[model samples]
Target: MTESTTFNFIDSARRTVKLEQEAVGLLSTHLDDNFTRACQMIIQCRGRVVVTGMGKSGHVGNKMAATLASTGTPAFFVHPGEASHGDMGMITPGDVVIALSNSGETSEVTSLLPLLKRQGTQLISMTGNKESTLAKAADSHLYAGVDQEACPLDLAPTSSTTCALVMGDALAIALLEAKGFTAEDFAFSHPGGSLGRRLLLKVENIMHSGDQIPVVSPDTSLPEALLVATSKGLGLTTVADADGKLAGIFTDGDLRRAIDQGVDIRNASIKDVMTAGCKTTSPGMLAAEALKVMEDGKINALVVQDEGRTVGVINMHDMLRAGVI
Candidate 1:
């Protein structure tokens, strides 16, 4: 192809994006009671929001449904053509339907309207034409109208579909705010991902408990504490009292200080040189919260305690291993 032909293709792509951006920008001014009413319908929906469209509009509707589901609104996509073929059974009286058609006259989508109505499902139409049959038959209508298409023939769904997607996002976010949806609530829906781990993985879950924990009595020698710390690979060892309560901690920092002072490592007791009043955390605390505590205290390890009794210990490395950091 000629350089001119390449430039023409690039220009077409840029024009398409520009047109869609303009459409989305204009959508803000169109936000009114209709938008609020649309959000209210979805917010009050007792069942999933069923999204349906045809062709390119269908693609946009599918994404809109997914976005709604991920962000707090329960929604799923339904193919209108498939609905006519027996998928209409997916809709129940409790569900809400969001139908998309740029011309407001997609036969496949409009064909399902009567069945959705019979099921007592609320219809929310998203179309460029307010006068279209789909819009007129809906309980509420969201106009995703674009002044023009980016297609050279002005027939493609480019700008119209983008507006519909943006409008869907607006509806989902409004409902999210209405429902007081929070990050913690979102995390519950995504428990297997990194966000879920950060929100749900507690320090208790990954901490070294029982005999696996590196703990030494206060009377233990510094050399012995060092050996335990080295063997446990936690870079530190908890020093406990006769009552098995945390008394202090001997860390690599203490080792460095002892060497600098020419202290007798084999003769000195761990309690004598250990850091007193060391930071500690409860097992019930979130691992992410524990990470923050470690970062804020500028410490790498924390002794886990319950009722003043040392139960376990966790280090920064442990947090890393558990994907908490």
Candidate 2:
């Protein structure tokens, strides 16, 4: 084939995007009592939501199942072909089956309808053809029909797949809102990701506590406090009173300021060189929250306290190590 430089690639791409956008926009018209009914069915399901489809629809169904499962709705995907191969036993009377078929006529998907109905399972179908067998058999049918495919030949499943994915997302989000699913709840389902680390990890969990905390007495010499800071490798040391209450904090910045002011580190007490009224965080605070405090205060470390008593210390490095940063 000869390269045609005059053929407008940008214009062709724009047309494809416009068509897909219109396809997704058309879904708003399909959002009626049926959409609400599907959400209600999934919400009331005692068993998990079972999503199934064929080919391209199957791929979209897998993603839909994942989204539902992560957002507080218990759901999983099963291919229609797999369902026919003894996987239909996974469906139950209490379960809601969401079947995706753009044409609503995929033989593999349609073949499961009789068994789903016989098992008394709730059926929700997403299809482009309302007249198709699957749509007619579904308890609640979501019209995912597009004006046309974005493909130049109008034979591909681009727009149809987008509409199905968006509809699935809408169902998942509506159910999530109705269930009052919080970010903490979502974190529990995604414990391996950064979101879980941010929501589930606490300051005390990763804090340097007890002997690991670099602490010095108010009367301790600045040089000795520096030694404690160096030994602990936290870049700072806390100066506490005889009662073990926080008096102040001396950081590398404070040491530099003291040196600039002509104070002798060997002779000066930690309290004299320390910065008073240092920022502190509670042990129960989320590590993510502690990072916010450090960010807002422009400080690298925070002394963890409990009821005005010094307990531990945490720094930016701790947040980084714990994957809370």
Candidate 3:
């Protein structure tokens, strides 16, 4: 593409982002008692937050529901048209309803207003127009009004959707703080994510144990220890005493140092060449913590211990293969 054409596209993208950012920036001033009341309603909700909308608002509502659900607030989305077709059963009197409609007059959403009111479910409407029918019927309303759409035709839901999504996020975060939601709690909701893996995957879960662990007695010959390390493919072997208590560690680095010192690998005992005071980690500790210890010590492997006895071994390669990085 021509440089001028590329520059024009870049400039257009920047202008759109700037317009949406301005819409988001203006939302702070709109926060009032209604926002607080909405938070209170969600906080007190004994049931899930049922989000409902139509068209593009429905898409935004789905994302808002997911965000809320993942961040400690129990929530789910119900299409307004589906709600009219018996999906309203998903909502109960103890539930709080978050209705999104930019124009505040979407027929599909507004048509369910009377049924929702009859069920005594609290309604929190997010809309651009306070005077719209949906806003008028809500128990509380959050105005996500923007000056203009980012779309040149002023037709697509651009800045208005961004504002609505941000407002939803504000409500979810405010309720999360009010309820004292924590990272651990969030991890429970996202157990398959990287954060959950870092927080929950213990060293014991991934470390090589039993026959897979590379270990040699302190009196073992250097060549025998090398055999163990090679068989286990950990680039290192743990040296233990007669009682099976950890004594030290033998690594490729130690082997290289031994060779440089002209130590006879065929006749030397592992204790003579192994590095003393080896770094160790507990099995109960997180793999992330073990990874940190390896990084801080500038080492590639660690002995996994439990009750002062070496039970397993884990190397940097194991961690990488296990997605601990």
TM-score for each candidate, following the candidate numbering: 0.88, 0.94, 0.88
Task: Quantify how close model 1 is to the true structure by its C-alpha RMSD in Å.
Answer: 2.6
TM-score of 2: 0.94
Q: Residues 89-125, candidate 3: write the lDDT tens digits.
A: 8989999999999999999999999999898999999
Name the regions of candidate 1 deviating beyond 4 angstroms: 4-17, 260-264
Clashing residue pairs, backbone N/CA/C < 3 A, model 1? none
Please tell me which predicted candidate would have the highest TM-score against the true structure: 2
Model 3 C-alpha RMSD vs. true structure (Å) is: 2.8
Give all candidates' CA lDDT scores: 0.88, 0.93, 0.92
Predicted candidate 1 versus true structure: per-residue lDDT over 202-258, tens digit per residue? 889999998888889988988888899899878888887887777899889888998
Stretches > 4 Å off in candidate 3: 1-7, 180-184, 192-196, 261-264
Better by TM-score, candidate 3 or 2: 2
Model 3 accuracy (lDDT, Cα) = 0.92
